[model samples]
Target: MPEGSLYRMAAADINAAVVFEKVSKSFGSHVVLNEVSLLIPKGAIMVMLGPSGTGKSVLLRCLVGLIKPDSGRILVFNEDLTRLDDQRSADRHKLFALRRRFGMLFQDGALFDDMSVGDNVAFPMRQHTKMSEPEIRARVAENLERVGLPGTERKMVSELSGGMRKRAAFARAIALRPDIVLCDEPSSGLDPVMSATLDDLILELHRTLGMTFIVISHDTAEARAIATHIGLLYQGKLQVFGEAHTVLQSSHAHVRQFFERNTQGPIKVL
Candidate 1:
């Protein structure tokens, strides 16, 4: 089956792929995310950009329910995520059901080196579905081909190059064909060519399949190429959020300098 079919089967009914309302998270006295509020429209590629330690990844984790906010509300697919405390909750099953609607592509590939590429890609389906071995085999092949990594099924993850590994992980991420694909630095460690390729792939997926992509990347080149919208986070708050060109052309000193990559700006030099 084509990957688009899988995505259609997994797309959520909620109009917004993700909604954060006054969300705050802290590690003791250190506040990482403060009142971060945004609504990511369905099928849009929204890139969150900022310097290191600006909590971009933390917010991504929060979006995926990996980290709970200390306060405020997160509604994924219109379900109050905070209420998924346990199986006893009335909508717990439904909330968990939404889990399949999204997938994550980690910064480091995050693939198990011990497993072959095919096995790695098949991991989620194996864990979540009752599909037979042959069915999984076909699905993995289809996903690998979609990411331009056909016949990589038996290759060990360690054998792949940085770009290949990223692509492989991307293949795995989309194997389940999630409607919402949260990518944390998808092109972090790759060369310019590879990064561009990755960005192009994301754009293709977005346009062809209407996948909602939430990318957390400091790679300006990558972000500029693929993001339909942009959000800039600084000092535990969103400094700006809007359409790509508008936010990129903001008069805000911080936003300007950040995009320009100049030494002098509102970004305090430590």
Candidate 2:
């Protein structure tokens, strides 16, 4: 099916995995996100596109509760987020449990250079689980194999190439086998071939794991290849959003010019 039709069908369905409503955020005097709202469906790849500092990253952080919104609500699986409190407080335990539902692949991989590949992958399980040392080691190896990084358990983070580091980070992200994976700039810093390979790997994970994906990136080519849906963020606002191909075909000058890489369009050059 065409990508546009696929996105429309998904959006019309009532069972969205993640929903944002009238969300806004700011840093001091500068507004970062202005009443931004979007829905990312379950088991779908929703790529966020924007120029640098346009709140794409900010939006992701908001979704994970790393950054709170100044106003509006964030709902994951239809639960109010701002009400989340400590595990001991009322139904707050349920909200805290939701934290485990996501695995995030941050920009730059964020691997600890002091740790070995296996330890890096094992970090999350260590923090979140009571699993014994042996069990954690076993899980680490399994995750590494899952990411096609098997047998590199003792490898130091600094010794790996940029692509390898990204893969290792992916292994770490999936170690907990969460229901959603949030990736930031997943294809950045890699050559075209490596980027395509990364895209294929991400698609494979989506197909096999059935995990929801929220990818924040500016790479239009990568977005076209993997995004089931797309949203455009500009000037701290959600300028356009829909299925990937449909939104890209937008006649809105800002959308058209940004995607086409036209310098003379509505997106003011910095």
Candidate 3:
């Protein structure tokens, strides 16, 4: 079956958490995403794999309403994100409401250096909700505990090691109990053991919270361990996407080349 047809069939399911319909984006003459269509089901751990400039990050940004696509529609929980314009007040409100359902863990942790760990986790709740100080404190503790950073609330961001900082960022990501969590290179900058630990943490969080996770990563081992669904983007197109096992076993040239780590295939080294 064609990729578009497969995606359309999957998108027809009512349990889809996100649907990208022929989404395309361009930067001047350079095309980024070329009519990428996909369906991420609710509660799925989807790992998106690609080379550095294959538009994986662009797709994530489009999903979160940060960067608008030049064409096509993105549906989150049946609501069309492409239709919501931030320039208009009513649409801006809708966009904000839509964004509240998502939690983003940016690359480099993106934590405030000056703030305490607890304050960093509580920041979203304080901004988006009217929770009391006591309530915020309790929730912060709970999230910290969930991410295995318990009792480090007063620690400054600079005090934490690389792994600890990632955990702290993860703690903040789930602070609001979002329905979808977006992780950009969750295993980056960590040693092998720490990367595996983070992958385990992602699984634990998904199992416990039942949130859909969309992860952008280059770690093939991480994908093999945690991904329920897998996508490979190359040269601005989705070369392959499906169940993790199926994609891993794919005979497609791009998929095989990527999984096998071959130096020669359809994917040219640029």
Best by TM-score: 3
Kindly give the number of clashing pairs for every candidate: 0, 0, 0
Candidate 2 per-residue lDDT over residues 215-245, each given as its tens digit: 8888989888999998889987778888877
- Which lDDT tens digits does candidate 1 get at residues 1-270? 122232333334456777777789999999998887777778889999988998999998887777889997777877778667755766667666777888889988899999999999999999999999999999999889888899999999999999999998998888778989999999887888998999988998888778999999988777789888899898898878777888777788777887788889878766
Would you list the C-alpha lDDT of every candidate in the order shown? 0.84, 0.84, 0.92
Rank order by TM-score, top first? Answer: 3, 1, 2
Give stretches of model 1 more than 4 Å off: 1-14, 87-91
For candidate 3, what is the lDDT? 0.92
| Per-residue C-alpha lDDT of model 3 across residues 1-270, encoded as one tens digit per residue | 255666566666789999988899999999999988888899999999998888988999999999999998898987889999899999999999989999999978999999999999999999999999999999999888988888999999989999999999999999889999999999999999999999999999999999999999988999999999999998888888889999998899988888889989998988
Q: Where's the lowest-lDDT run of ten residues in candidate 3?
A: 1-10
TM-score of each: 0.92, 0.91, 0.96
Regions of candidate 3 where Cα sits further than 4 Å from its true position: 1-12
Q: Highest lDDT: which candidate?
A: 3
Record all residue pairs in model 1 with backbone atoms less than 3 Å apart, i.e. clashing: none
